[model samples]
Target: MKIDSRAASRTLAEIGNWRAVLLHGDDAGLIRERARACVRLVGGSTDDPFRVAILDADQHARIEEEAGALSLIGGRRAVWVREVQDSALAGVMAALSLDTDTLLVLEAPGLAARAKLRTTLEGHRSVAVIGCYPEEGRALAGSLSGLFRDASVSIDRDALTWLSSVLGADRGAVRQEVEKLILYAGEGGRLGLDDVQDCIGDSATATLDDATSAAMAGDRVSADTALERALAEGLSPIALARACLSLMTRLGKVMGWMDEGKSRQEALKQLRPPVFFRKAESFGKALERWDRETLARACEAVQGFERACKQTGSPDLALSRRLIAQLCLGPRSFRG
Candidate 1:
C-alpha cells in the first residue's frame, strides 16, 4: 500500500477505508500537514475531542486502544500519533489488526527506506505509506500556483518564479508565507514582484541562502554578517550546516556536467531552483575556485558540523561561526 505523490491525494480522500496511514519523510512539515489532512478527512476537524485522539511518541503504547475506541457521537474516529518511532511498530501492527472503522494516522518523519517500521507497514494492504519529501523546481512552482489559485489571488509570473526559488525548503514555511501573501493581497487581488518582495524578501531562508552563497564565494565579511542575521532570525545551526552542504552538492553537480563537456552556462542552467541572478557571478566564481575534490571535503566538513551541533554540550553557535570561517577562508583541508 505504498503511495506515490500523484496518488497521495486520492488515497487520503479514501482514507476511511484504510486501517492506518503512515506518513514518513525528511520534510517534517509536509508530514504534519498531510497527517492533519488525514485527520480532517476522517473526523470533521483536527480539534474534535470526542472523535480525534492525538498521541505523541511517548504515548505510542496507547495507539491500539485509541484506534479501537468507538465514537459516542456515532461516526468514525481518527487517532493521530505524532513523531512515531520504531518502538511503536508493535502498537501500530496491533492497531491495524483491529476490526473497527476508526482511522489511524501516524506521522513518522526521518524514517530511512529500510527502516523496520517503514518496511513492515509499506506492503500492508490495510495501511497506506506515503513519503513526503521537499518539493523543488517545477513541482514547487506548481504548488505555489495552486495555493494562490485556491486563495483566489493572482500572482505575476516573475513573482511566482522568485517565490518558488526561495520558498520550497519547508512545506509548512511555504504555507505560512503563502497565507501571508494571500492576506496581503486580499481576495481577487493581484500580486506582482514588488508585492512578494515587500512581503518575504528578507525571509530567514533567503538570509541563509545568502550566507551559504557568500561563504562559498569566500566573501568572509558578507558571509559572517548574513550568518549572524540568520541565526538571530531563529535559523538552527544544523540547518545552516545542511544548507552549506546542499550548496556544495549543487556546485559539485554543475562541475560534473562541465567536466562532461557541457559549457558553464549550460551546466549551471541544469541546477534546480537555478542560481539567483544576483548570486550568479559569485556562484560561477565559486565553481571556478573550488575543484570537485575540495567540494567533497567541504561536504564532509559540513556533515561533521551538523553532527557536532547535535551532541550535548556542543557549542553550536561557535561551531557554526568556525564552519563559516573555514568555508570563507578556503582551507586546503576542511577536517582542521
Candidate 2:
C-alpha cells in the first residue's frame, strides 16, 4: 500500500510488518534518510553484516536470495538496496513474494509517476511505498524552524525568511547548510538575519539577486555587470531568469497588499522573504516604477525568457542579456 508523507513516520515505525518498503522521490536526501531509518529498525545498525545485506543497483538480482537467507545472529534481516532502478522490478517483486520476516528496503530517487517499479510496489498488499519530494513555502519554513528548535537554537523571523529564500531545492543540500548554521551558532545560540547572512548567504545567489534588483530598478549598467558576474560565477541563465520571476512575484504581492489599503512600508514588511535592509531602497524604487499591469506583463515575459533558455541550440546568454537590458529600460522597451 502507498503511504502518504504525513503517515510515513507511523508506517516506518511498523516497518517490520511489511515484506518490502520502497522509498522513491525527487528528494534523494529524504529517501536515503527514511531508508536508513527502515534498515535500522529491522537490523540493529545499517552496517551490521550479520543482520543487514547492502546491495547496489548492479546486485539487485541477489535481493530475493539475500532477503530470504536467515541472519547468522538468528534475528530478522534487512536487505538494503541503494539506487534501485526499473530493471530491478523483477528482483523486487520476487523478494516481495517471500513469506520471510526479513525487511526489504529499496531507495529509488527520481522515479517518475508511471514507473513500473513504483506502481507495482504501490499495489502490493504487503509493501509500503512512500514518496519523498522537496518541501516549499510554509512546509519548508516549518522544517527549518523544527531543525533549529531540535538543536535548542532560536532563529529570528527575518533570518528564517532569508534562509528559505536562498536555500536550494535539494533537501540534502538544504539540510547540510542548516547543519552548518547550527554549528556556527553554538548550543542554545540565537540566529538573527546577520548570522544567517554571514553563514548561509551564497555568493552566486547574491549576485543573481543583485542582477535582478538592478534590472527591475532600471539601473542598466549595474544590471548588466551583475548579470555578467553571476554568469561568470557559474550560475545558469535559467537560474537568473527564475530569480527575476521570483522578484516579480514578490513585488506583485507587495502591490496586492498596497491595493488592500496597506501602506507601502506595511506591504513590504509583509513579504515572506522580507527585502534585505541594504536592498530595501532599490526594491522600493522598483516598486514605484512598476504598476500592477506592467508588473504582470513583465512576469509573463520572464517566464518566456526561462522557456527560451531551455530550448536546444538557443543562445541563452545573449537572450538573458537582452531580457535584462529590456527590463532595465522599462516596459516601453519590452517586445511583444
Candidate 3:
C-alpha cells in the first residue's frame, strides 16, 4: 500500500495494520506523525509515548525478529529505524520478509526512484510506502484556506501566493509563517499582500537568505561574509553546514534535470523558494562554477563539519569560515 503525503487525512484513516511502512520526506516531523498514527491504529497506546519500539538499522533484523516472534508487554509493538537509507536496508528487509505482526517503520530522507527499499515497499502488498514533499499551489492554497478557516480569518489571494513562494523547500517554515500571519492579522481580519510584505516578505532576503544567494552565486567574499553574519546571528554552524550541503545537492539535482532537456521554467517550478524565480539566477551561477564532482566534494566537506559539530566543542565559526573559504575558492585539495 502507498499513501501520498498530500492525502494525510485519508492516509491516517487507512493505516491500521501492523505491517511494514517506509516513511520518507524532507520534513522530518511529518514522517514521525504518520508513523505515530499507524502505531495508534494498531491498538498501540499513545498515552505512553515511549511504549513504541525505537531501534536503528544496526539492530533492525534482530528487532524485527523479536517484534514478530513475541507479543508486546500487553501493548502494541512498533519498530522504527531512523536514517536508514534504501541501499543499506537489504538484509534487514530480507529478514522482515519472514514475519508481519509488528509494525516496522523505515524512516529515510527523500526518495529518488533509484531507492530500492522504496521500490520494494511499493511493490509489497503487506508494506506501505509514504513520500512527503513540500506542498505548493493548490495543495498550499487548500492548506492556507484550512488554516484561515480554522481561525476564521480571511486572506487575499496575493498574500497566499507570496506565502507559497517565499517559504522554500521548508515545510515547517511555511507552517510557522502561516501561524505568524494568523497572529499578526488577528482573528477575522482580512490579510492582503501588504500584510505579508510587512511581516515575512520584508525580511525575505534579509539575513541567511542573502548568504544563501551569495554562496550560490559563487561570490566567495559575500558568501564568507554571509556565513559570518549568520553565525553571529546565533545560527548554529551545524545547521548552516547542512543547509550548504542541501543547496549543493538540490541544485545538482535540478541542473541534472535541466540537462535532461527540462525547460528553464520547468526547472524553476521544480526548485523551492529563492531557487524558483528570485534565487534561481544565483543557483545557476553556483552550478556553473562547481560541477558535479565539485558538488560531491562539497558534500564530503559538509560531512566533515557535521562530525566536528557533533563530536567536539570546537569554535564552529572559525572552522566554518575556513571550510567556506576553502570551498568557495575550490575543492579541498586531497593529499592522497
List candidate 1 stretches off by more than 4 Å.
269-272, 307-316
Clash-forming residue pairs, model 1 = none
lDDT of candidate 1 over 1-336, digit per residue (tens): 899889987898888889889999867778998899999988989999889999987898899899888898887899999988789999988988888988889999877789889999987988999998877668889988999999999999878877876663667777988999999999999999889989987877667778888888889899999889878877777557656766787788899999999999899888877877777887987887798877888888888887788688999999988998989977465533
| TM values, all candidates | 0.91, 0.71, 0.55
* Residue 322 local lDDT, model 3: 75
In model 2, the worst 10-residue window by lDDT is: 165-174
- True lDDT of residue 119, candidate 1: 93
Cα deviation of 326, candidate 1, in Å: 2.5
In candidate 2, what are the lDDT values of residues 171-203, reduced to their tens digit? 666687789889999889999999989985655
> Which wins on lDDT, candidate 1 or candidate 2?
1
Q: In model 3, which residue pairs have backbone atoms overlapping below 3 Å?
A: none
lDDT of 1: 0.85
Identify the leading candidate in terms of lDDT. Answer: 1
